[model samples]
Target: MQKKSALGIMVLAILFVSVNLRPAISSIGPLLDTIRADLSLSSSEVSLLTSVPVFCMGLFAPLAVVFNKKLGLKNSIAILVAAIGLFTLLRGILPTYPVLLISAFFIGLSIAIISPLLSAMIKRNFPTRTASLIGVYSFGMGLGATLAAGLTGVFYSVAGWPIALASWGLLAIAAILLWLRVKEPVAEVSELPLEGAASVSPWKNRRAWYMLLFFGFQSALFFSVITWLAPIAIEKGMSILVAGAVLTVMSTVQIACNLSIPLLLERWPSRHLWIMVSLGFGAAGVLLLMFADMIFIWPAAICIGITLGGLFPLALLMPLDENKTADDVNSWSSMIQSGGYIISALTPFTIGLFYDRFQNHMISLSLFLGFIAILTVFAFLLNKKPESAGE
Candidate 1:
């Protein structure tokens, strides 16, 4: 009974932390207009605000190992979560645009550290139940994004952008407090050597390279949509509130898909097939947005949301499938996520650049479609067989 209770607490802590991960980024889309108007920022500048944090996530991913070495994974994650809360709050309250940009960087860095640590923790503590736990937290992430995208406009309408943005920090604070009470499991300690470990560098492996590309392009699709979907909807003749609601519906469908995909994989375990299917849906959705009328926008959103919901967890799980030990998982995940996020971070900014130049969604949607094509190719190339150290 005591063990079960502890497990329950740990699960709750993980879910809460996951829930706090995406809102800082996702909430911006719905409020981008308000923020731009209030600050007198240009399209590229606004894109920078959205893309910089994502770039930082890649920049700071490897630092998770350093933090773990010094503070241990448990303490490092606690500190990171607390830092996320602090920076998120500051992001909204800062008096200057420059300070807000700095806050976004810190917030991204904090999330970067927490992201890999949570994956390694799940591997260490619930080795047999990785897929299920991943699904749970992925669901939390989707739910967090859904709420932020769906309701931030409403919140903005009520209390203004600052409070609407700052409010998400409270969720991070709650995660920190919940995490404080849960004891760190003994399994989290690294059994492998600390220095000069015999792990293969992921960069040298062709299969790893494919996985990295797969991860990167999928993230490119997800973040691009999260960053621009609301604006695109507004451009398509929807009101800001309705646009936000469309993003909300996408996220809501993502929550359902996030929960279902892992379980479906358990029965089928067809990684390539599932990934290709997701890409197909994403491509269809993008094409629909490009050519279809406003009446079809909700269906397009649903299709894209399902793509995000399934692809993210599957992409994450791929590292675990490839690596045997927790340390290897951490190393490979850091490499994959670092490179992938850095690549993915370019989507919004590049899309923004195209939009700024053309003053239309045509170039941006074309770029998105190009990414989907690249993602489909890489997903097909990713190895399905399990990999081990020194492979």
Candidate 2:
């Protein structure tokens, strides 16, 4: 009974923390124009707000392992979550662009630290239920993103961007409080392999490269859409409220997809096939947005959301499926996420630059489609066998 209670607390803590992960960044998407206008930021500068945090996610993920080793997982996560809340609050209160950018970077760094640690926590505590818990984690993230995307405009209308952006910090505060109440189980120590018996690096493996590409492009797609979708809708003549609704719709669909994909993966024999199919939806969605009339934005958003929902969770699960030991999982996850996010961090800024250069979204949408294509090819090329350190 005591063990089950502890497990329950851990699960709740994970879910709450996951819920706080995306809102600080995702909220910016729906309110991009308002923020840009209020601060007199150029498109490129605003794009940096989105891109910097994601870049930090990649830049700072490797440090998570070191922090976990030094501070212990729970304490490290607590400090990071508190930092996230602090920065998020500051992001709203701060008037200067440089201050906002700095806050955004710290928020990203906090998320980066918390992200991998959650995976390691799940792997360590709920080994038997890692996939399911990951699905729940993804679902929480999607849900948070959906709420932020959907409601930021409403909050903006009511109280302006400062309150709208800062409101998300409250959720982080709640998560931190809940996290503080949970006692972490003492982690079992595993002996590091001797120097001669060191595991093969994931970087040397072709399969790991393919997995990284798959993860990277999917992340690019998701971030690009989140950052640009509402603006694209507004450019197509939709009202701010309507654009927010479209984003909300997409995120809502993502929540459903994130929750269900794990179940499908369990039953499906070919993960690659599912990945390809999901990528196809993403490509089709981009194409739809590229060519379709504004009236069809609803369907386009749904397609994109479905793609994000399915692909994001699957991308996360792939690393766990591919690696054997917890150490290998950590190493591969760090490598894949670090490299993938660095690549992904470019998407929004590049797409924004393309839009700025061409004064049209065609080139940007085309670039997004190209990323989908790359991800599809990589998905097809992924190895059928599970990854082993010996390999």
Candidate 3:
């Protein structure tokens, strides 16, 4: 009974942390206009503020593994979650644009630490159910993104942007408290080598590099849309409510697809095919938003969201599938996430810069989506290669 209770607490803690991770990033889109207007931010500035935390996601992700080794997963997650709570809360009260921007960097860094640790924790705690647990983690992430898109917009309309921003920090607090309830199982500690735990280096593996590129590019694609999709809808003559609804629909579809894909992956020998299929769907989504009339927007939104749901988790799962030991998984997780998030951090700003230069959304959207499509194809080939599989 005690074990079951502890297990339940850990699960809830994981879910709560997962749910808060993306809202810090996702909430920016709906509130972008207000934040920009109030702060007199330029287009580039808006993009930068939004993208900075994401960049920190890459910059700080590698540090988590180091901390994990020293603190163990239990203590590391608690400290990181507290940091996330602190920074997220600070983001709400910051007095200037620079302060907010700096806050984003710290917020991003905090979440980055939490991200890889969760995956490593699951591998340590639930070895037999890694895939399914990861699926649940993915679903929680999507749900956070969905809530940011849907609820933040509503909150922004009702109470304004600061309130919307401040409200999300509460999730961090909730996660911190929940994390406090977890006690690390002895089996989890047994998995780590006590002697010279720091000797294992995941950077030596070529597969880690591949996973890094795959995860980063896929992340770039996910954030590009999350940051801009609603604005795109509004640009295409849809009302704000409609645009927000479209994003909501997309999030809902993503949640459904994320939950379903792991089961399918279990049946298939290679998930590489599904990765390409997701990119194809994402390409179609961006294209539809770029060129098609309003009638096609919902379907396109759904495609993008659902496709991301599968692709994002698939990226996280790659290192897990490939690594036999938790340390290897941690190293691969840090490398891939650090690389992936660095790429992701630049995407929105890059897209925003192009839009500022040309005042053309289609060209920017097309090129971004097209680039992701090509990368996805490359990743598919690479992931499908016999070498992509673990020993």
* Winning model by TM-score: 2
Task: Tell how far residue 320 is off in model 1, in angstroms.
Answer: 3.9
**Judged by lDDT against the true structure, how good is candidate 2?**
0.82
RMSD of each: 2.8, 2.8, 3.3
Q: Candidate 1 residues 126-164, lDDT tens each?
A: 879986787777777788889899988888888888888
Per-prediction TM-score to the true structure, in the order listed: 0.91, 0.92, 0.88
Question: How do the residues 264-369 of candidate 2 rate in per-residue lDDT, one tens digit apiece?
Answer: 8778956776787787788888888999999888998988888988888788777678766666766677778789999899899888787777777778788878
Instruction: Write down the lDDT that model 3 would get.
Output: 0.76
Cα lDDT tens digits for candidate 3, 251-368:
8988887787776887884777888788788888878878889889999988888788888767777867876766666656666777788977898898888877887778668866
Arranged by lDDT, best first: 2, 1, 3
Clashing pairs in 2: none
Q: Clashes in model 3: which pairs?
A: 216-340
Error of 2 at 220 (Å): 0.5
**lDDT for each of the candidates?**
0.82, 0.82, 0.76
lDDT of 1: 0.82
